[model samples]
Target: MEDENDCISSDEEDQLDFLLGEEFGEDDDAELYSPPNVDTLSSQDTCSSQSSQSISDPLERHIYWKDDNTEDNGNVDLRTTPFKPTRQPGFQTTNFTRRQLQHLKTPLHFLNLFMTVEFLTTLCIATNHQANYLINTGKYSSYTDNGVWEAVTTDELLRFFGIIIYMSVVKLSALEKYWSTNVLYDHCPVNDVMTKKRFQAILCFIQVTSPGDIDKGQDCLEFK
Candidate 1:
């Protein structure tokens, strides 16, 4: 009975050792089959190396089309293409002179206008003087017939000639032929000098903003 009990204990010991070895082998196999865990240090090193490889020169940013697709071998020279400036998308500068500007109107143009007004005024006054002279010298001075105009008298005839002379003088002077005797340039304000001064002042002000000399007188305006 002692020998049989000893044999039975040895078999139990052997069975227990085999079961432990199988469990340990399975644990080792599972550890080997599982995916590896990468270290943070190794990943950071690789990333730094890639960034260093990519870096070259700061001027490379301006160089576009510098690739294999371009004409040259993986590069392009800027000298070939060149750069031409384009007209921007807003108000551009013009080469117009000061005379072309609306603000800088020709002084002669204003002078002609003023001369026309003066001529009309002179004509009206001369006609009135001639008509009055004829009416006063007529037989029916009081005008027995209102519609009937009296025959032209010597005074009326003389006045007509005087008007012709006055108009001729006005035409010569107002044409800007003579600067000193210009009708528009009254020496004193009593002869509408203030109006002429204002007009000249406006011309000066316009010249200040635009780039030009204040072209005055007959030569300045260049009237035909």
Candidate 2:
């Protein structure tokens, strides 16, 4: 009986140990799987804090409630106004008088507006001076048969320009072909204005500025 009682007591001791072990294992599992204690605030308090931050931050509010046609700073909103297509006025010729417009009927009149009478007279004088200088220096003798160069007038200069324009329109193999006496090329309009010899003379000594004004180091553009 004493041994049986001792055995029962031992079994009870084993069951108590097993139950204590189970209790400790359950406690360890609960500790491992449990959430951390970092989020301590209540849901209402957390939501209120976020709302206050959003209200305090202007950029956050702007991003949340932005509108397309809103004014930036104090300036007017350009997007609020509708775009209108406008046709600008065309260019009007108000610079010139009616008399001037009527006078510019002919192409010659238009040409004279740029190359005035004074400019042509200046060109004639310069050309004549160059020619006389070359003739007096005996340089003209080499180029001409009679060694004689008639002073060019403004009228002759105009005729020379007209002949040049005509020649440009009527392209030839050589410049001399314009004055060619061949039956196929006779009665050329250039011959009516000036002789070939006179034209050549004018072309050879067509000066704009006097030789005295020319300097080796001076810019040619200044003369232009």
Candidate 3:
């Protein structure tokens, strides 16, 4: 009777082990097959909340994230103020007389708009002043064959500038070549305007402002 009781106890232990193993295996299978827990909010609810948030926040509504092609359905408030022009558009010449309009037909008239007669006269006076200053200081002694330096006139200065512009367009190997009597350079009109000596004289003493006018230890343009 004792051996039969021992055998029954062993059978009960075996049945318990089998049941526990089946339960553990089922738990592992359930874990592997179960879906992930997601938020209870529906797609419509999430989209509506985002749209409302974007509408509330002005900065967020306009934020364009890189690689994000999604667009919000909320209406964007753009500045719609009508543009009232203060002045009439297009080139309409104002404050010009009929005589001035006739003068505008010449290219020199346009050039003089920037380089006015008063400005040219000032430059001519400055150039002459600088030349006389250099002569009085004995600085003009170095130039060979430079006879009594004549004062530069506004008309002569204008012609000088015209010659300079012409020279820039027609390049030459040497500066003197422009005035050369060589048949190759006979077509060049630089010498016809002014002699090379006069050009050199003007170039050497071209000054915008007198050196004496400038204060000591101050820049030329600086006000005292």
Candidate 4:
């Protein structure tokens, strides 16, 4: 009787093992990483088959490996090589002269600094300086107004506008290949935008100037 009961117990155990194999598959390898976060996985039955195969398959055992389970793990760094941009012909000198083209293609972020300075100078000349009548007449001695205050204002305005035009048209893009707004932060360490802009203008004067090609007067704008 005991021998018959032992046989029954063994049969029940084998049945349980067969049932587990059907449910989970043969290999029994637990995936370390979650599946890709995509909506298509909901309908996909690929993982179910995979799990079953992993649980039941004796030939395919789970091996401990890193995130990328490559057979040759040491050479993995070669996967991410940095890509350099190819230099295009005439990309640097289409608009500006050779002197103006030195650092022209360096980077857009640097070019933006000079562009901003030019814009600000133009704004000051076109908007703020236009209202001054006195400085204008003073600049032209023959057209001097009777009011001394008006003449003084006009003279200041003219000089101011002249400087602005020089900065905007000439010095901003001519002398340097790249411009940096970072200097503004260096001069005034405040977080205020207005103060930084003021420092940028001041630094522009310090850095930008006429090129040594004095013979090309038409090509260069004079700045004092």
For residues 142-217, what per-residue lDDT tens digits would candidate 1 score against the true structure? 4323644333333333333343444465654342332344554554222222222322222222111112223453
Question: Which candidate order results from sorting by lDDT in descending order?
Answer: 3, 2, 4, 1
Q: Check candidate 3 and list the clashing pairs.
A: none
Clashes of 1: 0
My TM-score estimates for the predictions, one after another, are: 0.15, 0.54, 0.55, 0.19
Span of ten consecutive residues with least summed lDDT in model 3: 32-41
lDDT of the structure predicted as candidate 3: 0.65
- Go through the candidates in order and give each one's C-alpha lDDT: 0.37, 0.65, 0.65, 0.38
The regions of model 2 sitting more than 4 angstroms off are 1-94, 142-148, 222-224
Using alpha carbons, what is the TM-score of model 1?
0.15
lDDT for model 2 comes to 0.65
Candidate 4 lDDT, tens digit per residue, 1-224? 22542322333334346545635766444332222332222333554335434543431232122444556544423223334557675445466767756655555435453556555445444433332332344542332235222212223333343444544654444332223346633432133222333333333322222233125646445554
Q: Tell me the tens digit of each residue's lDDT in model 3 across 1-224.
A: 22542322333333334445544664433211111221211222444445434333432332223333646455432431235678799745787888878778777878888788999998988888888888878886444345466878999999989988898899998899999999999899999999998888888998887656645777757666
Better of 1 and 3 by lDDT: 3
- Greater TM-score among 1 and 3 belongs to 3
The predictions' CA RMSDs to the true structure, in order, are: 35.2, 30.5, 24.6, 20.7
lDDT of 2 by residue, 122-205 (tens): 899899888878887887665455666667899999988888888888899998988888888886877777888889888899
Residue 213 error, candidate 2, Å = 2.8
